[model samples]
Target: MTISIDATHLADVTDFLQGCEKVVGSPNVLTNAADKSAFLTDQRQRFTGAAIAVVKPGNTAEVAAIVKLCNQFKVPLVPQGGNTGLVLGSVPDSRGNAIVLSLARLNQVRAIDPINHTITVEAGCILQNVQEAAFAADRLLPLSLAAEGSCTIGGNLATNAGGTAVLRYGNTRELCLGLEVVTAQGDIMHGLRGLRKDNTGYDLRDLFIGAEGTLGIITAAVMKIFPLPKAQLTALVALQTPDQALQLLTLAQGRCGAALTGFELMSDLCLQLVAKHMPQLTFPFSAHYPYYVLMEISDSESEAHASNLLEAVLAMALEEDICQDAVLATSSAQSKTLWQLRESISSAQAKEGKNIKHDVSIPISRIAEFISVTDGLLQQQFPGCRNVTFGHLGDGNLHYNVSPAIGASVEAFLDQQTAINLVVHDSVHAFGGSISAEHGIGSLKREELLRYKSAVEMQLMRTIKQALDPLNLMNPGKVI
Candidate 1:
C-alpha cells in the first residue's frame, strides 16, 4: 500500500519544508531523491524507506525549532545519528510522511572535566573521536565495538549498545552520567549533570537511553571516563567445546578478577569462514579445535606484570585440561592480529552468503547447555544448516548465527527466517535468556518482542509510550 496525498496535504508538506528551511538554512533541508538517498537506507542495505525530507539542524535551538515545526504540521520525525544502526530504528517509514532529523551537524565536544572524570559531548559526536579525546586526556572511554569508527554516541545511547569492553567497563548506559534530550513537545530537558549520585524524582535518563528515539531525541550526553590501564595483554586459547570455554571463564575470573577485560568465544567453523573469505587474517593456532576463546587482561601495573598474570591463567587452564592449546600474544601488534581474527567473523560470514543473526544472552551456568540443545534442535528441523556461534562469553552474550547448507539456494534458506528464529528463540527462552541482548527492539524484532514479553509487561511499556508521546508522532511503529 502507498500513501496518496491530496492537494491540501501536499500544501501542508510544502509549508512544513519552508518552515524547516527558515529554522536551519535551505541548504540543510534535503528534499531531492539524490540528497535523501543515504538517510533513507539502513546500514545492512536490507531495506530502503521513504522520507519527505532530511533535515539537518545545526544546534539544540534549531533542533527544538524544527521539532516544534514538525508537531505543528502534524509530521512524524525520525531522529538519526550516523545511521549505523543494524535495525531500522534510525530510518524513516515507507509512508513518506516523516522527516529524517539528522544530527550530523551537531557534532561537538561540549566539555571535558578531567577532575570529575566525565566528558560531555553532543549526540552527533562519533564514538572514535570521543575515544581519541579521552586518550588525549589520559583517560579511557571503554565502550569499544566494531562500529565505533562510524557509529554516533546518540545511536549508542539510544540502543544501549554493548560492545567488546562490556565485560569490564559495561554498556553505553552504565558509562553515561547524564543526557540532554528534546522531548516530543519540543521542550529541552537539561539534565547534563556530571554528578555520580542524584536522588531526585524519576530517573528520566534511564527511560530515554534505550528508547530508540520513540520517547524523545537525545541531543547530548555526559559519559564517565576512567584512568587508562598501564598495561594490556591478549591471548588466544583453543578449547574443545563450549563447556570447556565456560570452565576457562570461571578460572580466568577467579584468577584475574576485574583485570579480565575480554573473554570471547568462537567456534571452529567461524574461523574457517574467516580463512576462506578474509585471507589476509592469519589463523594463530597450528591446528583447529572445536572452539576457541580470545581473552584479554588490563593491569594498572607494568607490562611484565600483565603478561605474567595472563600466562598464569593460561597455564592453570592447560594444567586442568580445560583447554587443549593456547597462544599468548607477546607484542601489541600480535595482540591486534589475534583480535582481528575474532572481529572478522561477521564480515566473513556475510561474504559467504545470507544468514540469520540472533544476538541473545543466557545465564552463564546454562549457556553451554543452551548451545548444545539449540544446535541439535536446529539441525533436526533444518538439516545441514551451519551454525556460526561466537560472542562475549564472559558477559553471557552470543551472536548465534546460521548459514545455508552448501549447494542450497541462499534465498530459499532465508525464506525460513521465521521458522529458524522460532527454533532458536524458543530454546533461548527455555534457558531463561533474552532474544535481543544489545540491539534495541527496532521494527526488525518488534513482533518477536511481543511473542516473548508478557501482556502486563507489554501494557506497562505502552502506557509509558502513550503518556510521553500521546500523538505517537515520535518514531511511530517502533518498540511498541
Candidate 2:
C-alpha cells in the first residue's frame, strides 16, 4: 500500500527535506514528480515506486550529513546508484515516506596506485569510467557488464555483481579490498586501505560490500586492478548440447588454464532471437546447432601464442566430436562481433516480448544435468514455452529465462511467473544451486530467499540487520 503521511508526519517530512537541503543545497534536493521519476523506477521498468524526494549528495561528507538528518527526523532513505539493478534493490518501495539518496554526484577517481595494483574511487564513479581510468594507467579494472556504461561502482559493491570477467578477476566483492562506508548511524567508516592482506579483526569491508545498502551506504572503495593482458582472443564453438559444452569447457580449461578468461554458453534459440530482432549483427556460422559456447583467452605473451592456444583446444574438441564446428576471431573487429552476440541475448529477448527471468547458478558439474532435467520438467508443465537459456557457463551462472509460447498471450504467460519461479527455483535447490546467482535478493526474491534459506541462516541475517540497522531505516524492505 502507498504510504500517506498525516498532517503531523507531513510537517516532519518537510522538516527532514529542509534539513537535507541544508546539507546538500536546495538545487540538489529534488521533490518534483518529474525530477524524482527516473530514480523511482527500476531498470526493467517492472516496478515504479514512490519517494518523498531525490537528494543528490555532492561528496562523502554531504552523504553523511544527509544520513544524519534522516536519523534525526526518523525518515527512511534508499541509497541509489545508476538504478541498473535487475532485482528491486536500488529503488525505493511503494511507500512514499522514504527519500532517494543519489550518489551520482560523488563520481571521482581519488587515486590510481599502479604499484599497489589498486584504484581508489568514489561510489558514484561510472563502471566504464573506472575501466577507462585503469586502462589509461595501463591497468585493468575487469568488472564488466552490459550496464557498465551507466552502472556505478557503489551499486556494483551493493549487489556484489558478477560479470563476464568473473572467471578470472572474480566478482565486485573479490576485487574490492576496502570500502569507505557511511554507517546506518551516519558515521563514516574510513576503511579504504589498498591492502591485499590485512587480518586485523572482523572484516567490516565484506559486510557492507554485499549488504545492498541495508547495513550501510558505501561511499567509496579501494578495488584491486591487474596488469593488462598482452593479447586477448575470442572464439565461438558450436556444440550439440549443454553437456558437450561442459565437456568443451573441461577441455579448454585443461588446455588453456588461467588463459581461459571467459566461457559463455548460449542456446541456438538465443541467437535465433538475436538474429530475428538484431538483424544488423550478422551471425557468423553457416548453420545452427542446439547450443554454442563463446570461449575467450587472454595471454600474457604474444597474439600468435593466444591464437595458437585457442586453435589447438578447438582442434582437439572437434577431433573428439565434443563440438560440431568452431569460428576463431582472426581480427579485433571479428572478436568484438563474436562478443556482441554473447552480450546481445538479453536485449534480443526483450525486443521479442515480455518474459520471466531467473538469474540462477548450478554446481559446475551438474549444470548440464540441471538444464536437461529442468527443461524437461518445464516442458511437461508449460508445453511449448520458449526457454532462452544462456550465461557465464564457466562460472556456472545461467540466465534461464522463459518466453511466451508461440501464439500465447504475453499477459497470460506473465501471469504464470510465480508458478514458473517455483518450478525453476525448486529445481535449482534440488540440484544444489542458487536461486539468485549474480543478482542479490532484492524485494523481488525476498520471499523466495525465506523459502530457500534455513531458519538459522535467516535468523543470522536478521541478527546482522538488527545489529547494524537498529531503526530499520536504511533501505527498508530489502534483503532480509
Candidate 3:
C-alpha cells in the first residue's frame, strides 16, 4: 500500500506533461483533478490510484511519441483502455508520479476482410462496436461479454478475457492473429498480419496479448472472425443437483457437438438473488429448482432446425432424468429473456450485499465434485455463508462466490476473505485447477500467484519482463 514519489521525479513531471501535450494537443493531455479522476479508479472500485496527468493519444504514432518522452524522463506510464477491468490492472498506481495513458481517442476500425475472416481494429475500439462491425460484414467476433458496451478491445486482449462464448470461440488469445505494439523504449512494432499460417521466428503477438501492458503498449490487433450463425436455440433448464447438470452438459455436447455455443450453470440461490433484485425479469420456469442452466446452440441452418435440435436434446435429458424441468425459447424475445436471467446473476448479487468472488477452473469431470465439496467445507467452516455457484460449465470455469448470511453484515463477512480464499484456492490447487481462470494476476492476486507458481515459472516471467522493460517502468509493480 506504500506509494513512493521521488522528489526529483516530481520536478520532471511538468516537463513530461509538456512533451506529451506536444505529441497529442494540450486539450487531450489532462492534468486537472476532475479530468484525471475517471482514470484513477478501476471498474470494480477495488483500488483508487493517483496519477500526475492523464494523456489521450489519438493514434499509434502519438502513443509512440508519448511513450518515448516518458522513457526519456524516467516517468512510469500506465496504459489504460476503457477502465472496465475488474482487477486494478488498467488504473494508475498510488505513487502519484505516473501518467495514465488513455487510448479512447484511438478508436477506429482499420479494416475488415470477410474473405479472410479477419478484422483488424485499433486498440481503443469498444468491444460492442467491434462485434457490430463484424455483423455488418456478415461475420461474427464471438468474444461476447457483459461489459462489451463499455470495455475496449485492448483491455480485453490485455487480460485475455474469456466470456460466456469461450467454450466455442476461445479467449482473446485465440481470437487475435496479429498485433501492433509499442515497446517500453518507444519503438513501434508493426506486426499486424491477417495471415493464418505464419511460421515466424518468434510469436511476438502473444507476448503482448496477455502481458497486461507490462511488457509493451498494444496499439492495434488483427483478430480472427467467423461466419455469422444463421440460427440459434436458447433454453433454460432446472436441475436437482450439480451432478445432474454435469450429466446434462455431457449429453448435450454429445448430441449437439459444435453447434453448442454456450452452456452456463447457476444455483437456485443465484436465481433467488436475481429475482429479489430484478423483479421485472421473469424466470422461464414456474418453480425454482436447486440448480439451473441457460444453454445456447447456433448453426448455419433455419430456426426450425435449431429448435428441433434443442427439443431432441431436452427430450433425451428428460428421459434420463438429468433435468427436473425445462423451457426452450420459442421466439427471439423469449431467447433474450432467458439470457437476461443468466446475465442478471452478477448484478443481482451486487444488489444483495458484499460478496467474495472466485473465478476458478477445474477439469470438467471434477467440476461437480469440486462444487459440492467446496460448498460443504465453506458452510462447515464459516457458518451461514451463502454460496452462489455459476459459470461456463462447458469450459469448466465457475464463478463460485459467497455472500453474508441474512443477518450478517458485509464487513463481517468480508473479514473472512483471506480464510475463504485460502480454503477455496487450496481446493482448486488440489484439483489441479487454476486460481485465476479469466482474470489476470493484478495486485490482488500477485501474492497468491507467488505462493502457487513454481520457482522456474516465476523466474521465466521476470526474465521476460526484464528483457522487454529493463528499467521496469512499464506498469511497474504489476504481474511479475
lDDT at 183, model 1: 94
> What C-alpha lDDT, on a 0 to 100 scale, does residue 305 get in candidate 1?
91
| lDDT, ranked from best to worst | 2, 1, 3
TM of each candidate vs. truth: 0.98, 0.98, 0.98
Candidate 3 Cα errors over 4 Å, as ranges = 1-4, 7-9
| lDDT of every model, 2 decimals | 0.92, 0.93, 0.89
> Mind giving the per-residue lDDT tens digits that candidate 3 earns over 326-430?
999888899999999889999999988779999898998999999989988998999899999999998998999988888988897899899999999999998
What digit string (tens of lDDT, one per residue) describes model 1 on residues 1-480? Answer: 233332337767888889999999999999888999999999999999998899999999999999899888778899999898877889987878888999999899999999999999999999999999999999999998898899999999999999998889888999999999999999999999998999899999999999999999999999999999998899999999899999999999999999999999999999999999999998987899999999999999889999889999999999999999999999999999999999899999999988999999999889999999999999999999999999999999999999999999999999999999999999999899999889888899899999899999999999999998887888988888
lDDT of 2: 0.93
Better of 1 and 3 by TM-score: 1
Model 1 has an lDDT value of 0.92
Report per-prediction Cα RMSD to one decimal: 1.5, 1.4, 1.8
The residue-by-residue lDDT of candidate 2 on 1-480, one tens digit each, is 233542337667778878888889999999889998999999999999998899999999999998888888778899999999998998998868788999999999999999999999999999999999999999999899999999999999999999998888788999999999999999999999998899999999999988899999999999999999999999999999999999999999999999999999999999999999999998999999999999999999999999899999999999999999999999999999999998999999999999999999999999999999999989999998999999999999999999989899999898999999999999999999999888898899998998899999999999999999998989999988
Best first by TM-score, ranked: 2, 1, 3
